[model samples]
Target: MQHFLNSSFTIPAERNEQLESLLKIHCHVFPYPAKTKFLEYGDAMDGVYYVFQGRTKHYILAEDGAEKILYCLSSGWFFGETPLTLHEPTGLISETMEPSILWKIPYSVYDKLLDVNKLFRTAIMNCMSRKMLIMRHEIENQVFNPCKQRILQLLCSTVDNASLVEGKWYNLSSHYTQYEISTIIGSARVTTSKLINELCNEGFIRILNRKLQVSKIIYEEITDQMDLL
Candidate 1:
């Protein structure tokens, strides 16, 4: 499989030395299969993780056993910070969405790197702030956005913006089922299904096989509607 990080994203050069340092210490490459749980809710975290390939989901299990996805992350995204920072059990479950490769940096080495690497510290701080902002946006979308708008935003989030065909298509459905999409957007299954159909009818989105193809025109329309809201 192509490395998503190499295709459309590159790690910032400033953090290369820090990454190298971890490589020399406790960091090691690990592979995980789809649906494999790296950390369960309340499980103790042993380290921090960096995704080098494929996708993963950070979620919570509801009382009913349903997974409520908080974030779907691909290459360059890091995890295990909440537990590492608190020195406690993980609050959310982290699982693979696809066959994935990750670099695990044991907590002891993680602390050493943070103490000596200003650039790494800055990058991690920025990542944490971004994660918080994304959480806020997710909550706001669920509370205030219509199902159609919510779905549009969710689909757009998966776009490979650095690719040549970036805005023209998104392979979102390949990564998530309709039910999972509904859960992420906080919509009922019926509502999500109906809005998906409406989007297709309105020429706002098209699904070939499971890939969601999004046109620039539809993207502009979604943006305009969001602006109005």
Candidate 2:
């Protein structure tokens, strides 16, 4: 309900009311502090975690102890479902990117909602389908694209919803470190840094106050390359 924060589609008010009613009984909402781990690898998926506010990253710990970021989530996405649905240990770590309000709803409640709420089920399915598509694109980026292209794609995805001012995209940075970005794009930190500098010199992107703004020309160029891909 109320567009469910980061969701692309808005749920009908009635369906939202139904969901909220259940949440009142079965969900415990609380503020999770910044830099905290919401869930960790091998943790049991006892409930679904929802983002009422703030951002989070879902990552996996590499064998070498580096973090391999799977994706960043903001405001609307649900996590902890993998272990919940499959009855396996969590494969990823969910950490708060900032201070966040989270809802933890028990599996029993989730099951009850699914049994009785058609709209909620549909919304979950839609979200899952979109996530699957994102996974496919990520695989393609890792396997076929060069590091620069991969980084570009990653940046574009991060800023897709950023506000535009005078035809430039803004508020795309500060959410991640270069190393974290390198991990997500399957590149080295040094390489990512160098590429970022190159882009800056070329006037493709601008960084100010730790935020990134993509020039319209650069945006079009990236889109063109993506189309060709």
Candidate 3:
């Protein structure tokens, strides 16, 4: 599927190495186990975080205690900048999805680097711009698209290119639970489950060994339809 909006900013290899070198010099590196809660709504943040390895989920809890997943940050991604820049408590909750190695750069050091290093500053700006674009697309999807479409788009976007089977079935990079899918699409778990069954019945998607896979033909067809809208 065309995933212009779902794609995150990936730093070029050389630049990424440079970033890691810089972080190693100025940041505190630590390991976090899976399901670790880094911060919650209204919690104070000490500094910005860089995902040296593994992934994290960032979301907000609603009044009804429903989780609304904003996005997932994988290796090479940095977060916690918004609250630091604004000098305010975080509104979103962040948790590591798996065992992770993170680099924490204190706010003062982060600020100083931005002021003194043009490459670092430009990279941060590019990352922020990509995030804003993704957020805009998510808002538009929630307001205008149906839950089924959203779910399909999300699944298609996660297709693992390296695992494509006979050039038809595309394996998903991650096996997402129904509850997780529901939160991401802002739908109830039951609704998401029902729609997922519908997709399976229609030969669009299937689960094998608890891992989701999408049909390439169906993916292209759905994305083509979306392109016309």
RMSD, one per candidate, in order: 5.7, 5.3, 2.6
- Candidate 2's C-alpha lDDT? 0.67
Note the Cα lDDT for every prediction shown: 0.69, 0.67, 0.81
What is the per-residue lDDT of model 2 for residues 1-229, given as tens digits with 9 covering 90 to 100? Answer: 1111122111111225555555667788978888898677688887887666777778887788877777776666666765776778888888887998888888887777777978557656665666665576677667877887666655654554457766665555335678877877777788999998988888877887776677776776666665664
Pick by TM-score: 1 or 2, better one: 2
lDDT of 1 by residue, 1-229 (tens): 1111211111222335555554546678989998898888788888888777778888887797776778777776677876798899989888888999988888887788789988667666876766776777666776876777677666665554444254465443334678888778777788888888888888767877765666666665655665565
Among these predictions, the greatest lDDT belongs to: 3
For model 2 the local lDDT of residue 201 reads: 88
Give candidate 1 misplaced runs (Cα > 4 Å).
1-25, 161-174, 224-229
Clashing residue pairs found in predicted model 1: none
Best by TM-score: 3
Give the per-residue Cα lDDT of candidate 1 at 201.
Answer: 88
Model 3 is weakest, by summed lDDT over 10 consecutive residues, at 5-14
**21-135 in candidate 3: lDDT tens per residue?**
8888889988999999978889887788888888788998988899988888778777888888889999899998889998999988989999999877876777677678778
